[model samples]
Target: MATSTAAARREEARLAYDAFLEECPTGQLLARISDKWVGLIVSALGQAEDRSLRYSDLGRKIPGVSQKMLTQTLRSLERDGLVTRTVTPTVPVRVDYRLTDLGSSLGGLLSSVKLWAESHFDEVSAHRDTFDRATATS
Candidate 1:
């Protein structure tokens, strides 16, 4: 009886965090996960040789990301239970990152989005150019 009540309560709490509501916790999560850096870093880690890469390797793989920004995004992903950070004691101390199971699930979705953007950029750009020209004259 007590176990059943606990399970019911857990399910209720889970149902409360709706992403559709502006003030919901899931909405906050959407904002975090939707960051450009988050998507890129996740995709990079997911596509690595063994789904892991050293910190420096990640920075190199991701162009236009400053060291500080890379560090910050990795920290954020770590905090959110998406990526795992491992430290190895070496001459220079190596740090490696990999996506967790939860992150791997998200990785597939983000990678698809990245690929779609790559696939459709020319068409999207043409639409954007038309919009800009039309809006400029009106």
Candidate 2:
């Protein structure tokens, strides 16, 4: 009876997890972080000891990012409350972005994901190449 109850509870948990995934898909998160520029920006910001970066400096730090795309990504991150934007009063307005507490928590998660990708990317590529070769031969 105890074993049966435990099994039923496990089945209920699995169903809840599946329902949650269906309700809130990972596609949006993937769209936010999968972009080369976004990942670079997030990683760079995450690395900063202060966890903050000037708008102009950030643009220079991440090479190959267009002004438009960076602006868009920053706006999206700010809207999501993952990053905070501050405008400083100066001769010319100075703007900065810093990761919020929530965003800081995600840094470790992103780092792990990055490490996994680096470690396994070559193996995955090799597997794809082998599959392609086999298909060609067949």
Candidate 3:
């Protein structure tokens, strides 16, 4: 009886996990886009006249991003079909980043978030300062 109960519990857990994955097939995709650098990169691409940028240009445009993180984020975005990477056959190997239709669809949502953050940043900062001071006093 004890063994059977344990097996049932394990099966239940497995089903739950599988269901979660099914519902959130792009959970990791969302996570990648939520990253600071990823958001910056996506926003930059969205704003670009051509809607694309060279890898080196992206690295320079986005402040405080390391080469490794940018590379990883770009690869993940490409794999998730949100971003497309194009390579030009050249001596130094030129590469560019562009958004897919899916990524473009996210542009308005991200822009709204950006607008909210910018508009309320001062208020949020003040609240944080007050909270910090109160916590320190307590």
- TM-score of each prediction: 0.88, 0.69, 0.77
RMSD of each: 3.5, 5.5, 6.0
Q: Choose the strongest candidate by lDDT.
A: 1
- Please write out the lDDT profile of model 3 over residues 1-138, one tens digit for every residue: 445688898986677556247565355566666888778877878888999999999999888999999999889878878799999999999999999998888766776677799999999999999999999999
TM-score of 1: 0.88
User: What's model 1's overall lDDT?
Assistant: 0.95
lDDT of all the models against the reference? 0.95, 0.80, 0.83
Ranking by TM-score: 1, 3, 2
Instruction: Quote model 2's TM-score.
Output: 0.69
Q: Sort by lDDT, best first: what order?
A: 1, 3, 2
- Model 1: per-residue Cα lDDT over 15-90, one tens digit each: 7897887778998999999999999999999999999999999999999999999999999999999999999999
The segments of candidate 1 whose C-alpha lies over 4 angstroms from its true place after superposition are 1-15
Which portions of model 2 show Cα errors greater than 4 Å? 1-36
RMSD of candidate 2 to true structure, Å:
5.5
Span of ten consecutive residues with least summed lDDT in model 2: 18-27
